[model samples]
Every structure is written in structure tokens, then in C-alpha cells.
Target chain A: MKHTLPILIRKEVTQFRRNKVLPRIVVMMPLMLVLVLPLVTQMDVKNISVAFIDHDRSPLTLRMESHLAHSNYFRLCEPVGSFEEAEQMLDDGKVDLVVSIPEHFERHLTLGDPKPILLEANAVNATKGAQGMQYALQTIASAAMEKARGRGAAIGAEQLLTVENRYNPTGNYRHFMLPALMIVLLILVCCFLPLLNIMTEKEHGTIEQINVTPVGRLEFILAKLIPYWLLALVLLAVAMLLAWAVYGLLPAGAAALVFLAAFLFALCISGFAVTIANISDTMQQAIFVMFFFVMFFMLMSGLFTPIDSMPRWAQGITYAFPPRYVIDVFRSVYLKGTLFAELWFDFLMLTLLAVVFNLLATVTYKKQS
Target chain B: MDNIITVSNLTKQFGSFTAVDHITFAVSRGEIFGFLGANGAGKTTAMRMLCGLSKPTSGSGSVAGYDLRTQGEQIKRHIGYMSQRFSLYEDLTVAENMELYGGIYGLSRREVSDRVDQLLTALQFADHRDDLVGSLPLGWKQKLAFMVATVHRPELVFLDEPTGGVDPITRRQFWDLIRAAAAQGTTIFVTTHYMDEAEYCHRISIMVDGQIRALDTPAVLRARYGADTMEQVFYRLAREAKRGD
Candidate 1:
């Protein structure tokens, strides 16, 4: 076969540009999400007005008060001299978490007894409350251990199980999210767009016209994938520039590594997208199906959350997700500054996905009889 | 000439829907064979199977001397197919569409340029080469779509309703192109609901309710059915086929 993939890719690019919506989405999507969105939106959760109910007034309870006061996760709002002050603060949407240390908290804890700490959190914002509870637990455990160590019990087994968060210092939500968002956006414009293109041809009768020629299935497939792949890379580069310009954060690893990982991952994305195109009979159906795919991918790929935080079956589902692999490479490069050698497993999964998708598309693409 | 298209008990189904029932036919090389049917009468389904787009649920067939089931890829390489829509990417130029089809078929850059020049010259559309197809009129697009379909000069070309929307003038011009393609030794397998178009074919098969109720030339079908014209012949056969069903 004397097929020239570049010619086909150029033709697809020409077609894509002529399609007004696709070009606009590819160019403007990241800019809207990354820069303009961030300027409009905020991650700052500071100066939260919190209610305090100090029953003990002990030195130890005072220490806990200082921890919440100094922490970015909370602020002291009201002290419930009566039950109504704290209740009013909560009802007015002021305090998010209510901590109740029983009257004998310090006395029991200091006298070799484990103390019960009662805390209530807003159910509407349960995740935030969960994070707050986590922080509170760590803070109390460390403080009690420090006091115990001063009492010369620093060698306690409970003190040894300290939680360490070394990789994502400061736990910036944007840092955690930006890399995963890049993968999701790539899938949307990359896989979803081109697959829609292929399927639309079938629906509109264009593929039948094209098939009458000597066009090889492989060449046709390359034609379908290459243009969108390059467009996706351009989208990637734009997002990369935006990530740095907006967040003041360049990916900490090699540029070549990032590009190659993204390129290979795109094959999987486009390949699966073609199968979706084959299965769907209309552009609306294809787009609707793509929404389901993107939603499931984002949810399962640990884009906005941690995979380890999910149930085991959900974690297992991530193995089937192309974004999971893309996210793996993304975090390794952006967060860990990891080299390609360190991400061989992720690379391998993406390569496998590429092969699997290609195989499925090839199997699905039919011409005449 | 020996038949370039041959079928034996060709069958196709989707779930419980039987589109193409067991049908047998052979089409001679270089002959324009018309597939006539009312809407959803299995003509497109059978045409797709012959072109290698949809597999037969059972039975067997061969096109361009290649067994369809085992050598479909080879068969696809040798045959051209114009779908019912006769659709082309309006966003692409005439030359762009030609080059795209050429490249898709694995033609080299030089080959594409040469074929494009020849096609543009033959179609008398060299000046508007760079203009996108969307700018072209419906008649021009239909003709251009026909030209693109036959650009590879495959051994056989399947035209499925290639003249649906165009005016009678344009439709005649389309048949002239089809005739020219056939004259160049390309066997034409075409489908149409138009009785006049059916009369132009060397032989035609009339499909009704998933069965070929009549398979003969326009003259033969008219004579065999004792009707005045192919139109009357088709109506009678359709009535007969529906009664049989």
C-alpha cells in the first residue's frame, strides 16, 4: 500500500475546521475551563466562621482550640455560652463543624483513660466535613501523643502510625485536578469528536461514497484518527501553556515524555471512539453515548478524587479506563516529575488500550457485503 | 462474458428482521444490472451484502471473482459503492474529495494528482477544483459523488439510489456517467425505484416484500407479466408478491 497518512490527516483537518463547532470547542474549551473559570471561581476555603463550645476550659482543650483557630480548614465563630448561640451560628450557615469535648475530657485522658470526643458535621456538605474530621483526628492524635511524649510515653505503638502526605504537599485542589481534567478534555475533543465524525459519515452516506474508491480500511482508519490526534495534541499544548500561565506550574518532567505518553494515550481514546461511532447510528446518539462515556471515565479515573478512596470494585473498574492510564502518566509527570522509566506500567496499559481499541474498530468497520 | 457477480441462497437478517431472504442471481461482466424495489424491500440490504458492507446471515456469494465471506477485503478493494445518499463531505473541495478517496485507497501523491487531473478534465470541473463541494449545486454534487465513487475504476461499482434528489436532466446526466463507466468495462450494479431507469439496465430484478418477484429485462418482464410497460409489470408483480406473503 502506497498510502500517505499525512494527506488523509490534512483532509480530515480541513473537514474538522470547516465544521464550525469542533474547531471552536478544541480551541476554546481549555481556556474557558482553566484560566477564565479559575479567575471566576475560587478554591480558597479560608476564614470559615466556626462555633466553639468549651465545656472543660482546661489547658489541653485550649490547645485544641488553638489548633482549629490557626488551621486554614477552620475559624472560631461563636462560643456557646448557652445552647442557642451555637445553634444560631449553625442555623445561620456560619459554623460547618461542631466539636463537643465532654466536661471530663482532660481529666479522663490525663488519667490513663481514652476520652470520647463528640463532633457533629453538616450533612449537606458531608465531604468537607469528612475532610475536617480527618484533619481533626490527626491533630488530636498528634497533640495527645506530644503530651504523652512529654510524660515520657513517646514510644507508644499508637504514636508510630503517623499519616504522611509527602507527594502532594499543601494538597492543592487545582494541582490534583488540572492533570486529570486535561485527560477528560482530551477524551472529549479527541476521541469523542473524531468518532462522531466517522459515525456521521456513515449516517449521512459519506462513508459509502468513500468506500467505492480503493480506500483501504487501515488508511481510512488512519485518516479518521490522525487529524483528530494532531488536533488533540494542539489542544494538549494549549492546555499545557494554560496550566503554566494560569497556575504558574509547568509540568515538572520531560516534555518529550509528556508528549509521547499523550500521543499513545490518544490512540486508545480515538480507537474506542471509532467503535462508539460504529455502534451509534446518528450524531445525537454518538454524542449522547459520549456523555455517558466521559462521565463514567471521569468518575472512575479518579479525576476529581482518589482511586484508593473508592470501593474495591470501583478501583477494579479503573483498570478498564483509558483516562486512568492517562491520569497515571499525567500525575507522574506533573506531581512526581517522574521519568518515562518510572511510568513503564502506565505506558504499557496505554499501549494495550491502543491495541485493543484498534482491534475493535477494525472488527466493526464494514463496507459492502 | 462470464458473470462477475454471482450469488447463491444469499440471506441476511438483523435480530428477528429478515432483510434479504435466500436469493440467487448472477450478473454478467460489463452489464448494468438494476435492482428495483419499493422502500425497505431488501434491495439496499442485498446491495450492501454484494458490496461487502453487511455480511450474509447465511448462504454464500462471490463478487469480482472473490468469495465474499472469505475474501471480502479483496472484494472490497475491487468494487466501488455509491450509497443511497450519494453523500460527500460538503466541507471538502471537489479535488479534496478526489484526493481523499484516492489516498484512502492507498494511491500515492503523484497518482492522486494524475487521477485528480483526469477526473476533473473528464467531469469538466478543473476550474472549480479548490472550491468546497458545499458551494456546488445539488446536480454538480451528485455527478461529483458519482465520479469520486468510480475514481478507482474498480472491477464493479454498486450505485444505490444514486439519482434520488436530482432533476430529471441531472439524473439522465448521471446515467450517462454510469454508461461511460460501464463502457470502460466496469460492471454496474445499480438500485433504483425509477421504472425508466430500470428500463435502461440490461437486466433488472424486481424485489417485493423481501423476495425477487421478477428477474428479467424490462422487455422480458413486461412480456412475461403481460403488461404494457415495466411500471405496470412492477405493480402486478408487487401485488402478486404481497398476496403470496
Candidate 2:
């Protein structure tokens, strides 16, 4: 009786547990995202089909074909007789690349004047096309170098640059996506769940009854937000567990730092959602408004891509997104092993957004109009 | 009996339209006040202002001894309100709904639990306490809503179209509960479209086109309008209106 917040929180939690779909979704969504999405959303391109037009038909050409065949990057088609046939294969989508070795390819290599081989690629799928072509060029260059070295050409191993990838040494896309996917989980749990919860009460006419009660607006809003914030944190823990169990990916930095970032982001997003709920009277209005903003936040917040690579204007807009700050915290903490000192700016931005959104929620929520 | 509600010249305007135009009335302790009106006749609007759910555009009033304009939160604590729409959470069980409203009104857990038990037992639906309110029939939900509204034992309670669609038998049962509340000195301010129900009120006020055209006991109102029934008395006044619906 002293405080209604605890009772209100209990009601929300009970309703959430009793919901038919929400409980199931809360459990299954993160599991699916952690277990399944990593394998599919990978940026590492593989499984390219190359049709070889071996006009030279020399041992070097055969060796090149064999080398391409042996490599995991390219799958060889039956050697076509002409470029037209190989191009036809490319057009039919049967092959991604067409390699036409010239007639004097091996002879030119012996003369130390290697002829340029024609590499035709279907550029419709740009990343696959660009990466496939690059892999083919490297393979052919190395094969040509081996032949050149056999002829005593002065191409020493020291001439090639040795490159080393730091942090994520193997560049596993799953390791990168694990943290980003956790952020997506937060958006769904903290943002959308609280929004839908409030909208449901409005639609059902329950909020009207609550308005007539002696409860303070701040108390009511806190009641609405507390359950979702707790839920999002629990889901984050589950996601982290799944990431560790399935992908063997754990946060490279303090796990507590990752949780602290999640807590602030949950506060920001759930408050933002409740603010929108306060403004909107209907579920349709709330959903569309939230959808428009959440789409912008998720899409442009560098969750799937790097903000540094985006246009300057779009990158500037990303700074306003709360998700952008949290994503930075999560990625740096997970991949770069960044500490709280280095990530204080992102943490500060998230705290600022949380304060702003929660203040908006409280001020906009009118118990009596 | 002391006057429990004292509202004078309470007016609410929405843009160019006047929803509640200078309505004034008072209700004594333990009196059953019926606020009857046609569709869009502003009964709900006036009730909202009295319940502190909406602010009057202009006027001075007091509900349950609290200033309607300035002391809304205090007014809320001393009064109960049931909206026309079914407002009890459908996902919550019957006992849960009761406990929630009771807690919101600052009732202790033991007090809420005891009252819930008493109410459920009196209604002979103690077994249904664990059942969701959605699973209950409409009439039962309305009855439960009324019970939940008065769970805190406020000095005054407002019911907006409490019985819109229900069987006659159930409607009578609802009125019986109302009578019991008034017998214990709770002032009842209820709005309804049913003219027959108006006869049960200690006094009735009929509003048409944002103005109260009649306010008196049903027997006195009928005699004043030279009509035999309360329905005839209502038609005589309502027929003069230009606004419909």
C-alpha cells in the first residue's frame, strides 16, 4: 500500500508470462538469432563457379585449371571450347566467372612476357562478383609465379608483402554478428515489448481505469518500464550464453561493461518506446511510429555495416541514434576487447539518450487531460 | 444528510463545440444520483470532469471534498470510477484484477485478499476467482468492474453507462449491488441510457445538447411534465433537442 510500483510491476510480469506468443517469442527469438543467423548473414563469399576456356591447353593452363579446381573458392565447370560458350555459361547463371587463357599463355611465361588472361564475371551480385574475381586473380598470379620461379625468374618470397589480421585473427563473421544480434534482441525486447504492452492497455480501455487511480504518472511509467528492462537484460544473458555455447564467442573485454552498456540502452529504448506510446492513442499509430524510427535506427546505426564507410551525412545522422552508441560499445567490447575508459563517450551518449527519452515519457504521459 | 458532491456551472468545451454547458447539481450523502442523457448529450463528459479524469474548460466544483480543478489526485483517492468500456484487464484473473485496483488505491495486501474472498464468496463464484476476466460473461465482468471500483470504499463512486448491454435479470442484480453500496452511505453517480433504471435513483438529471433540461426525483419529474411514465417525461424534454446521436 505504501508504493504501487511493486504491484504494478507484478501485474505486467504476470501478463507477460501469461501471454500466448510473447513468452515463446522472447525465448525463441534470441536462440534462433544466435544459433541460425550467424551462418546465413556471413560476408565471407565462397562457392564460385568458373568456366574455363582453355585455348592454350598447355600443361600450365591445365595446371592453372587444376589449381583453381583444388582451391575451395572456385568450382570448375567442364572446360568450354570458346569464350562464347563460357560467356553463355555466365549468362545462364551456371557459372559466376569465365577464364579465357590465351593461345601462347605458357609460351609467353617462358619468354618472361606473360599474356593477360581474360577474366569475365557476372557483376549483378556485386560483392560475390568482386570477391570471386579477386580470388581468381590471386590464384592465377601465384600459379604464374610458380612457373616463373621454375624458370629462375627473380621473384623472391621477400618481394610479396606479409599481412597479419589482428584482434579477430581469422576474421570470423559470427564473432562480429554475435554482439550486433544481441543489440537487435534488445531493440525487440526493450523497445517493442514495452510499446506493445502500453498500447494493449489503451486498446483494452484498462489505461483509463489506471488514469483514475491515485497512482502517480511517474510511478505508472516506472512500473511499465521496469519489467521490460529486466527482461532485456535476461535475454542479453541468454544471447551471450548461446554465443559462447554455439559459436565459442565470448566478450573480449569485461562482461560487466557489456551488461552496463545493455542496461543503459535498454533504459533509452524502452523509455523512447513509452514516450511514443504516450503520444499515440491507437496501436496502429504507436506501431507505425515506432517502426519508422526503429527501422532508421537499426538500418543506419552501423549494425550490419560500418558507419565510417557510409556517406558523411548518413554517418552524422547515425550519431543521433541511441543504438549506434550501444552497438559501438558492444562491438568494441566483444571484438576489440575495449575497456570502459576507451568507451566512456559511447556510455555517456547512451546515458544522455536514456535521460532524455525517460524525461519525455514522464512529461508526455498525462494522467488527466 | 451532508452534501457529498457540490458542482456549480461546470462547463467543458472542445474547440467550438460545448460538450458540457454550465451544468450544476449536488448530491447528498447516501443518495443515488442518476445522470441520464442521450448519445452525445455530454453525460460522460460531465462525469469525467467530476471524476477528475478530464478538466472542465471553466467552472468551480468539488468532488468528495477535494477541489475538482486543483486537487485531482486527492479527489481520485477519495472517489471511485468505472468507465463505460470494460476496463478490467482481460488477461488477469478475477482475483488479480481486484487486487490490482485495491493496491492502486493504497489498500494493504491482507485487506485486498480478505475483500476479494468476501466478494467472490458473496457472488457464489469463489471457484472462478482464478479464471481470467475475459473468460467471464459480460454481465459478470460489469458486476466485477463495479466491485473493483468500490474496493477502496471511497465516499463517492462514478459509473459511466455501467449497464449498456446486459440481460434484464443481470441488470437488476447490478442495481441491487448499487442499492447496497448506497445503503452504506456511498454516493452513487451513475450514467445510463435505460429509462427504467432511472426510476431506481433517489434523484435523476436529464441532459440534452450539453445542457441539463431536467433534475428531480423520477415521480416528481413525471408529475411536472404531465406524463405517466419516466420514459414519457424523458421524451417530452429530449424531443425538443436539435442534436441527435
Candidate 3:
């Protein structure tokens, strides 16, 4: 049994090298997921278009328009003569938001009787609509405050509130998603690939030849797992390097902590994958079954969305998912510089899951029936 | 002659269906034992039982001096199995497949390399040792599977329909390999659809409806049944079977 493991793992490596698609995917997935996908998948909305209707043609309203145009959040369209024209642009999807300054809007304001500025937003996409409207309101309010200050009138409410974002100072969405993307790479390489390898053996009838030998079940399962485990780590390292090189993102904590969590995650996920493969008789069945679980693992494990934002029952479901814990460890260590002392519970859960799922893999595989 | 395999009242059932009913047999060491039957006659099941690939429903048996019920792992170490389906890894090179199986049986790297060399030369394809098994012809694949099965030099090897789809010339060549293995003191327990192949066996057992209908040398069975050929002798018994598949 001791001698059999290396031979099996070597055989797996040879087969992986010969396989045309798997090796290419290993090379391509990290490059695409790390170097390219982060730039595309940012959840923070930007590039909103605004059309301004200046009725008073006052200096204050023109300053407000310039302020909105200069802000990173909004772009200005050609000036419209009336509210109807601005609304037409919104209806045609030409602009995302419309701001109308009423007639004599600056005369009333200088007399200390302010007229409300009307802002209409195209709410077809709720996020763009709501966020674009909020940004326009803030820009216009600041412009009005500047006008009042020029006349020596004091603004009192500005000092009432201050906001500071934690961990990520700029609230960059890519920083939050980079660690989750590494977990995605781990799942595809460790869990998905090994399950497909085993299922392919079953489909081709090659496993029957191995089962007839005196090789122990643990030895065979470990042999299948070890190569992928090492490959997943290498892929993780490549992804981390790419994250730093392309996005200038690196773990704030000890890099070893991230690797340790990933190591445990690889064992846990691959063992779970093998158990699924043992129960499925064909590649199709195994793939569909694995797809179902992986979809849940990626979507519900806080890779794309926050677990804390999920409903009580939905968050409860994530506790059973091993990826959820490791993803937490990845995000905390990468963004917050969380130490192992603060992450002991996550490590314990990963270890427990690794032990349980691998035991299932060894027990469920039958040499004789 | 010492028996390498012995079984009494050995049976296997899948639910209410008895795949291999109560039967008894034994094969002495180095003998080329033929298990002949029509489709689903339980030949494969019986061979699987003796090879320790499946548990018997109820029986007492031993293979390679290991108890079938208690020492399955020990039995596995002393024997090799080639299933009806082609089971060699198709993506691997010829030498790699041989080395892998040899290594699984605990052969040292030196021993596996030596065996791979011997096999590549003996099979007369030393030049193609690095060729992928998938690229080889089907007949060659079957032969390579048989060679890899015995790479560890097991005392006994079970071949279940090893020549199912090959042409007669290839089948004859496959049988020659079997005869050579037996000559080297490796017991061969095999199943074949062709009765002419049965003539090459030292002794053949005819199975029908999960029971051994006749067991003897081909000549003796033909003579006893008053038939000119083993096919006639097989038909005379098998025509009485209630199941055809």
C-alpha cells in the first residue's frame, strides 16, 4: 500500500499531462479569473449619464451642472431646453438621470426662500437609478452650500455626520472579490477536476483494473487527491501573484495563513468531490451532481454575495458548506490582516470537514460487492 | 496436482435472481481451465467469486491458499483479473500501463522496468512501447491488457471473455499467449464464446442455467455425448436451458 500511492499519483499526472483540455484550463482559468475578470465584475455602479434642464440659467445652477459633470459618478449630455426634452432622453435610455432647475431658482435662494430642484432618474435598472439619483442630490447640495458660503451665510449641518469605510479605505469592489476568486479557482481545480478524473475512469472501465489489485482504498483515494491538492496550491500561488501583479492586491496578513486555509479547503473539497464520484455511475451523472453542489458552493458561500446580508435561514445553510468558512478566512486575512489566532474557529471547521469527507470517500468506494 | 482454486456449493444472487446457483468445482495449479457458457450462464460470476472480486451468496471457497470469505485481500495479491470489458488505461503508454500494474502489485522499479522490457520485446512491439494504448489496434489492446494483468506474475489470472470482438486469427494469437502463460506455471481460468477455443483448454466446463451441465476434457465430453464436435455436445445440453440470454 505504501508503494502503491506514488505509482497511482504518477499515473494520474501522466494522464493529466496527456489530456488536452484539462491542462489548458489549468493555465487559462487563473489568468482569466484573476487578471481579467476582476476588471469586469466590479459591483460598484459608475458611468451614469445625466441631462440638465437649466430654466433659470443662473450661475449657481450652472455650477451645479459643472460639479455633477466633474464628479466620477456622472457624465453630462447636451443641455436640454425643457423638462419634457430631458424626460425624452431618459425614456429613450439616452441618459440615466435628468436634473431640472426651475425658473428664477437662484433669485429665491438669494432671498433665503429656496425653490426645490427637481431630479428625475430613469429607474429601469434599480441600482443605477437609485445610486445615480443619490449622487446627483449630493453634488447639487454641495454646490448650493458653496453659493451660500460666498454670501457669508454659515452652513451648520455639514459637520453633523462623518463616514469612514473600514478594511478597504476606498471601498473597492475588486479587493473584496479577489480573495473570493481564488476560492473559485480552488474549487474548479481541486474539486471539479478530480471528480471528473474519477468519473472518466469509471466511464472507461479503467478503475476495475485498479480495484482488482491489492491496493488499499485509502491509498487509491489519497493518490487521486494528492496530485490535485498540490496542483490547486500551485494554482492558488499563481492566482495570488497575478492578483498582486495585475491588481496590486496582496494579503495584509501572513501569506502562510492564506495557504494553510487553502490547503485544508483543498482536502475538504476534493474528498467531497470523490465521494460524489463514487456514488455516480457515469460521467454525466457525476458532472450534473457536482455542478449542482458547486453552484451552491460558489453562490451561497459568500464568494459573490455577503453571508451576513443573507436571510437567517439562508445564512444557516452556509454553515454546512465548507467553502463558506474558508472564503471567510480568505477575505479576512486578505483584506483585514486577520491572524490565525482570530481564525482558529474557521481552521477547526475546515479540519473537521476534511476529516469527515475523506472518511466518506474511503468508506464509500467498494472494491468488492 | 495441488488445487489452486476450490469451491463447494458456491452461489451468488442479485435479489431474487440467482446469477450463479449452487455449484462446485476445483482447478489444479498450472491447468488451463475453460469456463464455457452462453450469454448470462454465470461463467463470469463464478470466475469473479474465485478471483475475490465479488462475495458469494453462500459458499465455502479458497483461491491461492486464501479463504474466499476471510482473506480476500490476500487472494487479491496472488491473482490478477481481466474483465469482459477492455480495462487498461487508454491514455497511457504501453510501458506505463505495464509499469503501473506491476507497481501496484508491489514490484520494484527495477523489476517493473525489466518486465516492461521483456514484454515489449516478447510482444514484438518494442518500438511501440511508448505509443498510447488508445492508438493501438483493439486486438493489440486486448493482448496488452492480458500482458499487464500478469506483469506482477500472479499464480492465477482470470480472463472473462478476453477475446469477445477480435477476429479468429487474433483470438488464436490470444490463446497462444494463454498457453504460454500456463506453460510458465500460471493457472489460466478463462471464458470464451467459441467452442473451438475450448479445444485448447486442458479441461472445459459447460454451464447452463447457473449449473455446471458437463465438466471434462473436450474429447471426453464429445465422446461421452456421442457427438462429433464440442459444439454439438454443448448444444445438446444448452438447448434444454430455459434462459437464452
Please report the candidate that would top DockQ against the real structure.
3
Once fitted onto the true fold, the runs of candidate 3 whose alpha carbons sit more than 4 angstroms away are A53-62, A78-89, A99-120, A137-163
The per-residue C-alpha lDDT of model 2 at residue B186 equals: 92
The residue-by-residue lDDT of candidate 1 on B166-194, one tens digit each, is 89998998899999988998999999878
Candidate 3 local lDDT, A1-369, one digit each (tens): 678888998999999999988899899999999988888988777889888888888888889988998999888888788888888888899999989889999998777676788889888888778878877887888887787779797766742123357999988989999998899999998888889888988888888788888988888888888999999999999999999998799999999999999999999999999999999998899999999999999999989978999999999999889999999899999999999999999999999999999889888888887
Q: Whole-model Cα lDDT per candidate?
A: 0.79, 0.90, 0.90
Question: Candidate 1: how close is chain B to the reference, as a TM-score?
Answer: 0.95
Q: What are the per-candidate TM-scores when only chain A is compared?
A: 0.85, 0.89, 0.88
Q: What is the C-alpha lDDT profile of model 1 across A311-348, one tens digit per residue?
A: 99989989999888788888889888998888999899
Tens-place lDDT per residue, model 2, B74-189, is 99999999999999999999999999999999889999999999888877889999999999999999999999999999899999999999899999999999998999889999
Name the regions of candidate 1 deviating beyond 4 angstroms: A36-44, A53-75, A78-80, A98-120, A132-165, A253-257, A339-342, B13-18, B57-61, B106-127, B208-217, B220-226, B243-245
DockQ of each: 0.50, 0.77, 0.82
lDDT of 2 by residue, A1-369 (tens): 456999999998899899999889888988888999989999877889999888898877888888899998889988688888788888899999999999888898667576878999999999899979888887876776676668686875643323345888876878888888899999999889889989999899899999998888888888888888888899899899989988788889999999999999999999899999999989999999999998998889989988898999999988789989999999899988998999999999999999998899988998877
Q: Residue B86 in model 2: shift from native, Å?
A: 1.1
Question: Which is the winner by TM-score between candidate 1 and candidate 3?
Answer: 3
Interface RMSD of each: 2.6, 1.1, 1.0
